[model samples]
Target: MPDEQGHPELEEIELGKVLAALADPARRRVIKQLLEDEAGAERHCTSFGLQLSKATRSHHFRVLREAGLIRQVDRGNSRMAQLRYGEIELRFPGLLELIRREKEEQASSET
Candidate 1:
């Protein structure tokens, strides 16, 4: 990856933080959105537009980074977030896919 100007790579993150971060619905939505793209897809944390406080957003991202779910770097004025696809896949096989499928099923049913 091109480092997004200032973000740490996946190898620099911790694992436990990622899990704790994803344990929440809001944070899980952030991860799910990022997973929609290929590797190195830089997105703003707020792109999820979750109804959360700014502090909460930062806390969620921090957890994801520490858990190894994402790699974020400062991009000039805004922070860019990217999912650690390969790293996460290696660590947990088919986990993302399964969760995403479940989420889709839930959404469909809700409609």
Candidate 2:
């Protein structure tokens, strides 16, 4: 079932879509930023600091949103994105933990 915002319900979230969305480094970076953010704090898309062009960034966000990894809503003139943390955690336990660990490893490797 779809929520009012059109995002997938927790039980309806699919592993394939989620994994496909995270397969893109840019989308994973976006997810990592949201994971690091304070709980329930929606972030403006521009705040992600991605190097992609506006259109490309939009595409990445859209892919994530459609995959049920994140929820996007309009806040005034800007689009806000937030990880579906609790839902994702309950639906696929340890998945976010794995993503967080992966990001940490990548960050350390880049240093």
Candidate 3:
């Protein structure tokens, strides 16, 4: 069950890994941006606007991809990222919704 890009598939994406990936503030921000995008729309890596250095950004993307939360593809010279919403939903049902709701609550409380 390799991804199109040849990344090895997890026999089962562990809940712990998913939780750990989401635990990072930067990765959560990336997930939030992906959730805000229209379904099926891919965002180029540059469009993320993360303030981190290029290497750090790449590391974040790698974590998310390996965690099965995102699918990335190279478009020309740029990488495009999109949430693996449907696949994740199939695997973990309300997990993403719970994360989104928590993020929304946090944002509202800060203002």
Candidate 4:
């Protein structure tokens, strides 16, 4: 949705929603995978090795979308999901970096 300024209007996505979306390890893995891909390339949700039911997978994507962390677009039979990296970085600088660092720390601790 665009405001009068012709720029994409970022709706005030709830912090709770964002946190809820990030709370799941699967969702965090999804975000980490998306971040690994270079900008401008759209990723299909099924490309990830997430062992979730179809409905659960949809729910995860929906939460991420509603939280404004990702932008999903329909491309015929497949839907493409992309990280809103630039917009999110501008809105909350260092936030994603912190999350990634935490993920790395957790992985290292488990090893």
TM-score of each: 0.75, 0.87, 0.83, 0.80
Error of 4 at 12 (Å): 1.7
Ten residues in sequence with the least summed lDDT for candidate 2: 102-111
Of 3 and 4, the candidate ahead on lDDT is 3
Better of 2 and 3 by lDDT: 2
lDDT of 1 at 71: 81
lDDT of 4 by residue, 1-111 (tens): 533322243556556766787877778778888888898579998987788998999888887887878888879999888888887787777877766666554633442
lDDT of 3 by residue, 6-107 (tens): 343545576787899988867777788888888878998768767889999999999888888888988899889988888888788998887776655463
Which residue window of length 10 is worst by lDDT in model 3? Answer: 102-111
For this target, which candidate reaches the highest TM-score against the unseen true structure?
2
Candidate 2 Cα errors over 4 Å, as ranges: 1-5, 104-111
User: Could you tell me the lDDT of residue 110 within candidate 3?
Assistant: 45
List runs of model 1 lying over 4 Å from the truth: 1-18, 104-111
- The model with the greatest lDDT is 2
- Residue 61 CA displacement from its true place in model 2, Å: 0.5
lDDT of candidate 2 at residue 76, scale 0 to 100: 88
Q: Candidates' lDDT values, in order? A: 0.71, 0.85, 0.79, 0.75
| Per-residue lDDT over 34-67 for candidate 1, one digit per residue giving the tens place of the 0 to 100 score | 8787767999888887778999888888777666
Clashes of each: 4, 0, 0, 0
Winner by TM-score between candidate 3 and candidate 2 = 2
